[model samples]
Target: MGEPFYITTAISYPNGKPHIGHAYEAIAADVIARFQRAMGRDVRFQTGTDEHGLKMMQKARDLGITPKQLCDGMSSYFIAMCDNLDVSYDVFIRTTEERHHTASQELWRRLEANGDLYLDRYEGWYSVRDEAFYDESELVAGEGGDKLSPQGTPVEWTVEESWFFRLSKYAEPLLKLYAEQPDFIQPDGRRNEVLRFVEGGLRDLSVSRTSFDWGVKVPGSDGHVMYVWVDALTNYITGLGFPDETGDFANYWPANIHLIGKDIVRFHTVYWPAILMSAGLALPRQVFGHGFLLNRGQKESKSLGNVTDPLELAERFGVDPLRYFLMREVAFGQDGSYSPEAIVTRCNAELANSYGNLVQRVLSMIFKNMDGTLETFSSAEADDVLLATVFAACRDELPREFAAMNFSGGIDAWMRGVFACNAYVDEQAPWTLRKTDPDRMRAVLLTLFMAIRDLTIAIAPVVPTSASKVLDQLGIPADERSYAALTGADWYMARVATGEKLGAPVPAFPRLELPEDAA
Candidate 1:
């Protein structure tokens, strides 16, 4: 979080409603951006739609609308999903925007001027579903012996005269970039896969297509539109008002990370860097291809009819609970199953029963017994080794996991703190101590208050709205929500707000059983 950190999610191709997979990437990127901001970093987060694609054109034609009209109608759905998730993207760029067209044309000119573009008759197997081309060897055979892309997306033979980018010439350079910056592609598996693909052989890439008019037009080529990848990938720079890198672009260019889906790893890790190299632009620091979200052990897709509407899930359980389950149930960077069973389990057990119950019980006891005013803490009980260990462990582990983009690990680390607090409350029996040793009871409540305070700050990125409520009940000032507030002075008996009256506490996560409201 020291340097300016810029990150992006692959722009959604706005042909339909965004599924859980789309929300997964957005939430992950948002967590990183929010965490970095909390760490006091200058962070720029970008996400949006890749509206200029063959798919969008087809969808538009099927609807009897122009592609622009289709993009306008569909992009709002993606924007709505981001808003519903509380994604704090600084910019939502659409490739159809004029700025993107300018940036794309500039990139094309740079590649052409640098001798990377050559017009040639192209013939190959292409996957419309994937928006990518595949070589004969890269194709998989189906049960019917039909050719398919490696991901099993069906491929069709296509021939067109197109502009080619000299990707073959940059193979060594791209590999060297990977070797020099070992983290160029992340999650080791993706890095290795990209390396193997490049090592197999480098082929010049088709950079422009004449088949459709729905994409950014190649500079000086009236009949050709830039290939979707070429046009779409530039949105990263275009979002910053690229080709003009004077302000936003100058400050945040060469993004810290491009957080893309695993399916698009090759385009981001391979072709993207090659194109940037031809333009003499610095590569993005990292391209992390996180795994897909599987619903019922199968990928969420329209064809499967299992594509989950993110808004539906959010409506069933409050937005924060939905956010928590996704980051908690799924290990970041690996395929994780999402099922109603898993969601309800995490929502009821972790959020409602465990974490929520702890907060409500502790605050209710203080309110009913002590008039909700915090009293002086006495750390006389050395038996609170468990609670002490929790504070130390969370202070050590939470930031480390968060910085590494392991949302699950970060939340797990915080849950260690949560579970310990719950265990401490039971072991100390604050209610029993309230009558016998009132001083001891005060100390115990104070300890619980401090523990909740620290945890609320730690969890703000994941469950912001609930954490804000928790912080308010703890009498935390608006400005002190950052981790800095948790540091300094023995946190066991915080002098920051001694004898402060806490606001009335409400249940954070209520146990869920499907009702009409959930619909």
Candidate 2:
């Protein structure tokens, strides 16, 4: 409705190779971006790596490489993964990039100018693994009575001279903002958590770290660098051209949505907005903290050796199916498990049996009987009913489902059309009609063709390759392949060129074979 829709996935920490969890988030965000674009909205999708963090520095040290080298190498892998996943991101912003550092420093300067930043001595429990400072109340007793962070990462007491942001001063203002915009932080539970945290009390946030030298250097400060969370959080604005308010920045600022994991809801909902308010900037419209992807029964992590490699999965199973499973298997804002069998089951049931079979059977019937041309289907009553239903699904039902981010529900509605068409073909018995009533057979085949064309367009955002294959089979020209065209009957009248051979139906989703003992 407005100029364009802008969405972003939280820039991932490139401490290690990306796993299925990372791929899941990217695919989810990409689906939303693609759907909005298909609805004729200009869409800007942003995703990238967060390279400046304590964990990243530690990872660089472990790899015996410089931080830049490690980040560059790992960031490349993430970019390749996005490509493999068919994620149409507009820009990839790395925290180590000059643009990002410049933006981060500018944000700091704005906060400093507003008198929100001050030098202070910090003494608290810090976790390098978590890149977070924990209060004593948050630490739990570990084995041998050692204190552990809530994340189960070890913690140690640290004292340093750090710059602190006046987060405590903005607590009341943030609570008021949250009350004014109840939908600002999504999924109710995440919002409640943030509200409760703010209600309890707010503490001054350490914005700079004197210990980490691998981060953005604080403006006018030689020994201190901006903290990783503060640096990484600035990327949303930086990617849009924050400080200068340039054309691109002005065009996409006040991002429509920020898609992040549930683990970091605090930084996004609380700290990030507080920083923005301190700098006299508008907060993003929505911050949706989607849940994690669990492996074996626990959260996926490097130490557990349970992390699923996204590239390997893409290579084994096609990218579309993997992308489809990620969105289809779980509700967008809930934690879900990943098993090879679950992926295979969804592909076989939804893609192969439901969608793919319907298209193949319809096209095969048309090719054999009418030579793939339907001149006058509008006159037939049965044909009109099927066409009406398919159009309703594509034009009304699917769009509503997608608007609510119910991707699986949207695909299910589209699948209902597929199933109904299949049943209609069987009941009409086109093969019998071809001999007894040639005119009836033409109507039936035409109805099937229209249904196939509409369903393919509806599911294109989820499975582009397979949808394109359906378009090729229908002889629909590239120009006619759009949501608007599919919803109207005008596109159906376009003459199908005779003798154009349809491609052989290769299995869109082949069954996955697993060893008996593997599960």
Candidate 3:
């Protein structure tokens, strides 16, 4: 087994309901965690909601409810979405939790002790909608000559007393850290952008807010509350038992990766790491900024009234197919548009036609000719080559693609296994051999069976429901369906349990029909 691995998705800000973009990040992190677990490594997968900030306060006011009441309702939706999406998180943390508040306070105290925090009056362009401050250069002219944030949210000038973190002091060290660990931030393009921003200069970031009381209070600072990002980021450590320093925190303080959306890459890659450095803590191993999911060629935003509900999509299409299509549709680090047509095409071509057909045909033939029991066969030259290709694809090419977070490429590689198995079936002509040569027929079916087993293991993380279906047809137990247990082994010993009935194999992804307006 390799060293322990840890990963986390950016805790979703529970200002509103969940959307497809939120589901995408959670699914991506879940896939990585599942893959690492299958590799026989101890894996910690954390996810949760960011329940504090100006946005939450505004939302509470809008709803005519307390902040806690707002969070209680909104956070439950986010949590329910994670459960619906099968996010196998080891811990689901909420920034509003007492433990998280404690951790954030301890981090603030440490930074203060190191002279990295100071009391300051902040007067600048602040976006209550974003809970973020923007530099003069970043503010753009909006309608009626008003200023807008970089995210295009309207900004207003605000003056308040706040606690500030000396982010500018660690700019040089941050650049140095990036220089030392080039892979610390995902996709070369994102890393380059962050580096350019830091190289230009850093500003001391406001770490607390006095205007909003719906947040964790800074230690000994009654009026000031810890900033949302500051409070939320601490959940990564708090979930691991930070400040105690004797439990999971000591083991997984520096998470292997913090998976976040491109919009907040700065918070995770730049601000979060600087905060950790200021507090004399190790930074996370990598911060991956995954691209956004666009709806009908436009970014999904609630204000735009174009937010795509993930549950609605899953209800229309199966969950695994939606999960697979999202990851396979985009290159992972570049924004990609979501279209029903594209999804249906992928499902028909890849899922139904390729992977599904391969499994159905293989099992149907085995059930008919072999009486649902496959006979052992020696590995032929062609079988050896196909198996070797599958092994190389998983061990070498798959890792390289996953390391870069190219989930689409990884899915394509997995499909190659399905393609190879189909090709092997064609070349062997098992249908013809069943009548002409019984021995050769068994060999062909056995080879295809092994290939199916290997393919099931490889694609399990992406399309787990369908993979489970395939494995069930083959009568393999769920516990025995691990990747580590599948590779480079004599699969003849693997038996299909007698009297086991194959589950009904319907189309995993039905064709999506777009409404006329969407069309």
lDDT of each: 0.86, 0.83, 0.82
Measured by lDDT, the strongest candidate is 1
Q: Is candidate 1 or candidate 2 better by lDDT?
A: 1
Rank by TM-score, highest first: 1, 2, 3
List residue ranges in candidate 1 displaced over 4 A.
381-387, 490-500, 514-519
Clashing pairs in 2: none
> Tens digits of per-residue lDDT for model 1 on 1-519?
356889999999988888898998999899889888877789999999999878888998999999999999989999999999999999999888898999999999999999999999999999887899889999999999998899998989989999999999988998898899998899999999999999998999987889888888888888899999999999999998889968988888889999999989999999999999889888899999999899878987677778789998888777898889888988889998877667887889888888889899988888888888865555865436655766665566888898888888888888888898898888789989988998888788777777777788888889888888887787777877776666645543454447566666888878877554322
Candidate scoring better on TM-score of 1 and 3: 1
Clashes of 2: 0
| TM of each candidate vs. truth | 0.96, 0.95, 0.94
Candidate 2 lDDT by residue in tens digits, 467-501: 77768766778777766676555665554434354
Candidate 3 lDDT by residue in tens digits, 402-459: 6667888987888787788888888889999899998888877777777777777777
Instruction: Please give the TM-score that candidate 3 achieves against the real structure.
Output: 0.94
